[model samples]
Target chain A: MNVPLLQVRNLTHSFLEGEEKVHALRGVSFNANQGEITSIIGPSGCGKSTLMYLLGLLDQPDSGEIIINNNSISKLNEIQKTQLRNEKIGFIFQFHFLIKELSARENVALPAIKKGEDSEDALERADQILNQLGLSEKLDRFANKLSGGEQQRVAIARALINSPSLILADEPTGNLDTANSEIVFDLLQRLSREQNLAVLLVTHNNQLARRCDRFISMNDGLIVD
Target chain B: MTMSLIGIIFGISFFIVTQAQTSGFQTYFIRTILGTNGAIRISDRFQDMKGTVNKISKDGQFKFQFKSREDAEYIDGVDYPGKIRNALSEFPSINGISEVFECNAALQTKSRNYSVQAHGIRINDHMIASEIENQLMHGSIENFLSDEMGIFIGNRVAERLNLHVNDRVNIVGKKGNFQLRVSGIFETGVSEIDKKRIYISLATARSIEGKRFGGSVFQLSMFNPDNARSVASQIQQTLGHRTVSWQEREKVWLDVFKALRISSAITVSTILLLSGLGMFNVFAIMVIEKTRDVAILRSIGFEPKDISAIFLWQGMIVLIAGIVGGVLFGVIGTYLVSQIPLEIRGIFTTDSFVVNWDISHYIWAILIATIFVSIASWIPARRASKVEPAKIIRETI
Candidate 1:
């Protein structure tokens, strides 16, 4: 058996709201393998986004051990975490968070550029990714000028530019119409199967969650099933 | 950014123009002072005139001595004056030397008598070495030199005595009184010199002082007046006489000039600092406005230092543009100021304003401005780099 791409053991986190302590997660344990789409679905305030933040290395859990590619990340320094994030994980957000001033290709190329890739090569790779995502005609359009679906596709292209081993997307199609939503979910599923990438998606859409390879439902910050 | 750049331009251009103008004024003042007084002056007190003169022969070489009615002992003059002259003549820095015979006397007009300092000079040689001859107000130096008892009076002396060219005045010396004609009037622009000094011929001076006062001092002009201190020291060491350089003689004025230069530097530095603060505020506002963009950049794996560099590069570009534009504007403004026909009257009268086109001022202005801009930009850049991407993203969502 291949080693799991991600492993979280006994993760726990909480914060104080004025006079009351609110526990966001309580000793949650999870694991994800390569070439699999793990959909995390839950009701509001179920700590789904909280779990995603911890998994993405954007926050440190109060008590937990996170292992990515068999390297423990719980004790990693900020710089090491940043390096790991840059080299091993990619992220997509609900709002499409594209830099409005940049063109579609430039937006896609930003992550590769930040990773210290050559400008010419980064730009060429961005073009190839956009073309593969059926955005060849919109490569030169500014992020603000693109349609809702095109902008989401550009955001997806930016995430894929680094070619990371794991993709963590939080509501990647939450703002899209039904047709664009289907298209985006199909693209994520196909990319996971074809590229052998481990994908963890947080969503409230039951129809989309059912289509993922494995679905984990959460309630009161614990994985009930 | 535009406002910050404008501030830098104003600061730099103001510094450049003021430096040029101040330097021009200082140069003119120094040159005028040097023109009235030679670069160096060597003189002797001759306290023991009798003992000094007894050691020399009554030969043609040493011709005169300082005589007083009360002192029975007297010397003929400086023994072998030619030997001292010849010793100083060999110096390559010496441009020319003028023999100066000086005495304290009283001038009497019809109504009043006033104390005066009388200078007896070899007219042609003195004219070649000093600027007094060229500053004549009423008559020519040639005319002043032609008469046996002719005198050139300063403007203030002529005015106070109500005298003019061709008016005869009586000069009372220690030994005798001599009648002299005011052949010319000159203005040196120095109030002390113009009010009390009178120039006469060497022959007339000898007659009034009983033929015992030859040249009492030597005024030396140098090829480069700035080297006067070293040259004066050499002359003093060589001849054992007292020597004073122009810088030492006008130390008070030089001190004033130094103070003015220091104050100008302080003013320019303050202006540059204020411009830097203005730049800092502009960048700070830019960072604040782009908070979300910074968050996204951070999320995409751009290090904090890289984010800082981007903002710093923007500031540097603005600073460079400001410096270049300011230098060009300063040069043009200086040129315009130089063309204006403005006359200034102080210790001397300048016919027109002058501007010094010194390149060092330009370079120093640019260097100072750059340093200030870098400091200003770095502070805001560091703040921008510390922005938390997760917090901003969560808040915005």
Candidate 2:
């Protein structure tokens, strides 16, 4: 196949601890194809999150080449990195992290607003997305007023506001109950298929990982297929 | 937020009161001088004239004539002969006509003789000054008119001359030596005039020079002190003679105002700078505390301009709110304070000094100070726009 949508090669990352050295990621590599749901699973401290951060361009690897859409983004400047991230990537965090001051619809429309969309249009789109997530009635509710699952849904709507091509979820369902977790996982899978987006989700749940098209297990700092 | 706004309001109010006090002093000075002297003085243009101001000789006299054919005919037939006669006859009749002449006097002090200001004051003119008169410490002004050689002196002059009321003083003028009795003293709160000048009745100034109702100068008073300048000019035009308004007559107050302006500007700038620094700290802290929010905004696609605009709008809101609260409190507080008796008000007045705050100064103070604060808030707002989304998000999370 042509180059994967995202490719990581020989990614190595480490940190210093006083006199000691701690290696977080060691020359690991992974390729995630377009329009596929790829999950990365590992225990805590195995550097799974670190690898994901590097791949997401939220952190840099000491030695690695990260290619997105067949362009090696390892050399991109901060402005270019931010531009690419804003234009092509979306993130879903376990905490939701919706701004407390804004209403549910405003939280969801935030990304669209950042993209310079008209406020009314962004609000309309946010309402539409919230409705799809069964949150139409809570559009005006403040973020703090929402339930955990409702808040997570609002966050998902925010991530989708720019219609980004790739979605990165880090334990998106970590704080939810089994039922809410299943529901959120199901929604993520459905959104990937509906929007034809490439999704990479990191989770400790074997069941959630199994639902993706493919799963890569990380041990220590290396990925095992 | 309201408490913070209150703080800002208090700051603005302090500034307003300070400015009002200073401006009040200035207004008080101007009014005191204008009240003591004539609202306008039509004088001769001497080296001391400075600008359009003219100083008529102190002995200058005034007389009134009517604008009527018969009266004009009588006046020309009796008083003026030649060209003045023909002109007087040509006019139908003229009211407020005055023929002024000069009386030069050389004042003898213990050390030397110096030129002293003298005025020819008629009974009506004497009454005008008498209305504003206060204790002069020695002689009565009525004594000045009792004898052509007599003159009135103020407390300041009595102190300086080493003489008391009714004391004999010798005056050597162009007309010759005349010993005069000290007359009723008058004090108008003008230290310079009180100490340096003496007053004489129109009859005395005219008589000493062997003259009857003729002076080279005339001082004019207007219905409104505020419009004295314009009226004086109109009178000058009407009489076809030069004139000087109160402002032109007294330039010391103008210099005083200029100095006051500089000092006031310095005072205002210091207050504004303090408030601005306070606002800056507030804005900087707000920005620093909201770093994560700024990152969130940036991640969501907020341009730097948008971020700046939000803060700018917030600052503007704060400014407007503070100014409104400040002005409301300042005006009301000053009014309430002014209503109290001076003795009671002295409690707040420092060292027994009280300045009744004027409303106009209070309003202007808030406006100017708030504009300074708004400008001060811009620096932090600009710094806020430089916040990094990725760095803030990663670090904060």
Tell me the tens digit of each residue's lDDT in model 2 across B3-84: 4466667766766665565565556566666655656544432222223333455677434332321112111111221233
lDDT scores of the candidates, listed in order: 0.83, 0.68
Q: Which interface RMSD does candidate 1 score?
A: 1.2
lDDT of 1 by residue, A84-124 (tens): 78778888888989989999999999889888999999999
What does candidate 1's lDDT look like per residue over B79-189, in tens digits? 445676798889999887877777778899999998889888888867756887677899887677678788999889999999999999999877788899998999887
Q: Please list the residue runs of candidate 2 whose C-alpha ends up more than 4 Å from where it truly belongs after superposition.
A: A1-3, A12-23, A54-57, A60-63, A71-80, A219-221, B31-117, B120-292, B302-313, B328-397
Please, what are the lDDT tens digits per residue for candidate 2 over residues A1-225? 323788889899986667888798988888887667899998887777676666666667799898888889877986677667767888787777788899999998877776778999999999999999999899999999999998888888988888988888878898889989988988988988788788899898998899898799988888866
By summed lDDT, which 10 consecutive residues of candidate 2 chain A come out lowest? A50-59
C-alpha root-mean-square deviation, candidate 2: 12.5
Pairs that clash in candidate 1:
B64-B76, B65-B76, B65-B212
What TM-score would each prediction reach against the true structure? 0.76, 0.62
- Chain A TM-score per candidate? 0.96, 0.94
lDDT of 2 at B393: 60
**What is the Å distance of residue A37 in model 2 from its true position?**
1.0
Name the Cα RMSD for model 1: 9.0
